[model samples]
Target: MAAIDHFWAVIPAGGAGTRLWPLSRSSVPKFLHDLTGGGRTLLQDTRDRLAPLAEDRFVVVTGRPHREAVLGQLPEVAPDLVLAEPAPRDSMAAIGLAAALLERRDPDDAVMGSFPADHVIPDPHGFGEAVRTAVEVARDDWLVTIGIEPTFPSSAFGYVHLGEPVDGHPAARHVQEFVEKPSVAVATDYVATGRYRWNAGMFVVRPTVLLDLLARWHPAFAADLRAIAAAPERLDELWAGLPKIALDHAIAEPAAAAGRVASVPSAFHWEDVGDFDALATLLTGAGSVTVLGDDDLVRPVDASGLVVPAAGRVIAVVGLDDVVVVDTPDALLVTTRARAQDVKQVVEGLKQSGRADLT
Candidate 1:
């Protein structure tokens, strides 16, 4: 497949990644760490995965504090294209701002694809093909999302309700609605229906169409984004006034309700690596303890879990299964896979105790 002309890859790289504490911090979020021990950070890997489809057409929207770090990770993306938000707004503002800027630069027929910087896709070829189909569908003015074919009934991610077959695109379908994360039992039922897909938050659309859809639900928000795009100098003054809302609630869901959304069912294996459990699943080998860093520094006896020896200290796990141990210079996290989500509570405790530096 060839590069889609005027297609800009917009990356939203702002997240606390609290559950992945010690290794992932607000100062240097998960996207900046090589959680897979794959040499490149998640942000850099995202750039690599998107490079073929987006070539040099890229825009990264991140928080002001992480702007320089995002540049350090992605030297290929032009500095001018890295937009920094003065404050932390949700996905709607981060992605919508990029769309608005592209809407101004390319104006008439430019397409922008928004992907989160922290997610991992092991199958780039399949991902590119899915993106290509999505871009083609987006060219017809439909807000297209790359919906991953469900490998299992996962309660971690939202589901895309697949409707009728789209007229022109081969694998595309009209998206009936976007379902929130369901209970495991409900998710099991959703997977039983072949029409459901994991909503990967991968969207491809013409910038104008995106902003216009946003304008319908949030007129002032859309206007503010456009105004900031028109006068980049005004972002500081105007950004504070914009409502902090997610793009899903503000546009995608409503668009689906209006019969304006389409989905491309994708086979590419994707993972958000939301917590230690996800990271363990991605890196762990069958019947073995997975060490993300310096395997020699880790010693396990009848243990099957994830161990990160980031502190360069020897870590010994004895008779443990499904455990998570992450050691950094300043902090260490010890927990079980069943309670991985509780790590965020540790972060909150640190913040309240005025030890936020350890968080």
Candidate 2:
């Protein structure tokens, strides 16, 4: 695919990823690790996937602590292109800062696509096709989001209710509203209707359009972001006051209600790699032991699970099914696949116990 003209890829690389503990720590988050065993970190994979479309046009918004790591992983991006947040303010502020900067950087015809740094899309071609269509739709001043076709009723992801077909773009649909994550039963009904897609938080919009939409509901917030963009030194002063809210609640949901949002439905395989269960599913099939690191280090007799021998020590699993074992030099996580979501509690406990270094 050829590069999209005036399209800049904005990557937001900030998350604790507590569900993937030991291997994924605050100092080295999930995006920084090779979760897929593909050698490239999730952040690198994200950039590589978008490179064909955005080329050298890239902007990475990350926390101050991980800025150097992001730079190290993606040296193709200039140092100035990586915007570091002084403190964690959530998705809206991080992405809005990119929008505010791009709004001024390219005032006329710049369209920006915001993609999370941690998502794993196996088929880059399919993703590229969807993004191209989204960029085309965004040119008409619509807040376009590339929605994933749900493979199952997933309560973990938000849903985009598909409305009427877009007038000009046949591949695009008018988004009725953005629904928050629902129960499995609710998500089942949504999937059965065939009118909903998982909201992957992948947005393609003109920089000014995004900022202007944000301005409608959050005038001061928008103003502050633009002010920081205008005077870069004021970011520290203005950032603390910015509302700590997600872009969905801050803009996307409201825009959908106002009938200004569009969605490009895609069937590409997308994985957020939220936890060990997800990572295991992505790496291998069920009923088999999958080692993310060196296979020689793992010795499983009757185990069907995932193991990461990061500490380079021999890990032996005996008569266990659907178990998760992640060993690092300082900490080890042993749990069942069924309880992978609860791993975050361990991180919380460690933090409370003054063992922040382990997390």
Candidate 3:
């Protein structure tokens, strides 16, 4: 294995994962759930997958409420590496905090790889190689984002327009533009063109380079983050004033507009697992899920493309195809696989109706 002395990983493990409601709650985020084939929690799998590349230099940036959960899942991670955010301030602040913290350790041209904890990458080896490639590209002082070849017209994900190929690395292309999540038809057009890739939301860049870009592009945010890092005790004060902006909106898109962003085509299979349908796809193709009980036995009876996660609970699905039946102790969710994206609306309705238990 190649030594990754200059490489570090920053995992953002916040977010309630409302899409996976009933099962994923504020107490248990998506990263803590077992939504992968290997049975490892998403956070653990993410850390372990990058172990060969990042070695011991990985930081988990999570909200203060989830500190214990993050630590419990990754006991091997040092206590200092588990940086806790006083509140949720979105990805820009998270990455800024990580860069600020990492700058304190290795200020010199250190490469930091940022990833969300809930994403699933099926091929670890391929993922690591892609990271290595990104690291090399980052050495040139350009922000590098991993772009997944779109297998389908996915409206759930954002897209990156690929410009001309880089002079040296043919696999990586200059980023022409970053498009927000598009409509199904627009996504289909993007897929048909074959010039666009799904934005994986994973990035690699040198700490100094990121700090420089943030300072240049968002000076106020950069100052606030630095102050927050310096005064760790007053994080609450810092977070109170930070804006809720994602890295894509705050950094990547701006950099791309400035012709400073590039992308590497990812070889590994990646899934954001943003909702139940995504999770169902990851949990399928393996062991059969069985829910115990006489009155509520939910098995995949003569049905394909179904997910029954009511383990040990009573669930019975008599005639269902391409359906997701998730039974929780408090609530039950039965929806067609195609309608899984609307699960968030259900959560919203539950919240509006003040049904905390259902959520």
Q: Best-fitting candidate, measured by TM-score?
A: 2
State the lDDT of candidate 3 residue by residue for 68-146, as single tens digits.
Answer: 9889999888988898887788999998899888887788868999988988888988988888888888888889999
Cα-based TM-score, every candidate: 0.98, 0.98, 0.93
Candidate 2's TM-score reads 0.98
Residue-wise C-alpha lDDT for candidate 1, range 212-261, written one tens digit per residue: 99999899999999999999999999999888888888999999999999
Candidate 1: C-alpha RMSD after superposition: 1.1
For this target, which candidate reaches the highest lDDT against the unseen true structure?
2
Model 1, position 254, has a per-residue lDDT of: 99
Stretches > 4 Å off in candidate 1: none
Error of 2 at 110 (Å): 0.5
Tens-digit lDDT track of model 2 for 1-359: 99999999999998989899988999999899999888999999999999999999999999999999999999999899999999999999999999999988898999999999999999999999999999999999999999999999999999999999999999999999999999999999999999999999999999999999999999999999999999999999999999999999999999999999999999999998899999988998444799998999989998889999999999999999989999999999999889999999999999999999888
State the C-alpha lDDT per candidate: 0.92, 0.95, 0.82
Evaluate model 3: give its TM-score.
0.93
Name the lDDT value of residue 283 in candidate 1. Answer: 95
Which portions of model 2 show Cα errors greater than 4 Å? Answer: 285-287
